[model samples]
Target: MVEHGKGHPDRLAQGEQAITEVAADRLDEDGRHEGRLVLTPDRIYFLDNEHSSGGHDDVIDHTRFQGAEVTGDDTVGTLALNWSDQGKVYEGNTLELRTFKDAIDDQLNP
Candidate 1:
């Protein structure tokens, strides 16, 4: 079987297991932007769809993560993630908040 999405999961980690993938977003100075969220056993990847004019990728280590949660209703909400890097706290999330949280929780617990 073949999988399809905005980005390629294979580009993440070679020979590593992929837990899940979803269309998501990341927090930036401008605002929330569309991105491809890929989950592995030990890391979370938020990569921008290269086809887009301005796209980038964020590789977050689970150990550096401080916390994560979903807020607001399905109508209008945000997926929030907190992490510490270089002594600074960083935030990352997607507009599909609930869906993002569920995927992360399932992988964390399963």
Candidate 2:
């Protein structure tokens, strides 16, 4: 069964492999949330520390992933994920953002 409320690695579904995970701040209209941005083969999960009490704050399936854009200075960057009708942004270390971009790009292409 697919786990919907937990944020830890143990919450991942069986046979689902994590491609990348990083400590980042998820940005939304309301505010920023500290969370782990986890990219798995089937979904992109924003596991927020504060908002994950009952349901997922954000979970984008691979088929819904449209594109990603990264922008920032030398030390930090923001990764913006674009999907069908919505988007999500995460701010974190520059290198980590690049890693996320690459992984997402690979998924989109392959």
TM-scores across all candidates? 0.66, 0.82
Worst-scoring 10-residue span by lDDT in model 2: 1-10
**14-57 per-residue lDDT for model 2 (tens digits):** 77767777778988887888888777879887887786462655
Query: How does model 1 fare in lDDT?
Result: 0.58
Q: How big is the positional error of residue 35 in model 1, measured in Å on the Cα after superposition?
A: 1.3
Cα error, residue 33 of model 2, in Å, equals: 0.3
Give, for candidate 1, the lowest lDDT window spanning 10 residues.
Answer: 85-94
Where does model 2 exceed 4 Å of error?
Answer: 1-7, 54-56
Error of 2 at 43 (Å): 0.8
Output the lDDT of residue 51, model 1. 41
Q: Per-residue error at 92 for model 1, in Å?
A: 12
What is the C-alpha lDDT profile of model 1 across 1-110, one tens digit per residue?
Answer: 01223257556767556566666655567566666666677877776764443236676677776666666553555556666732211233334455556767776677
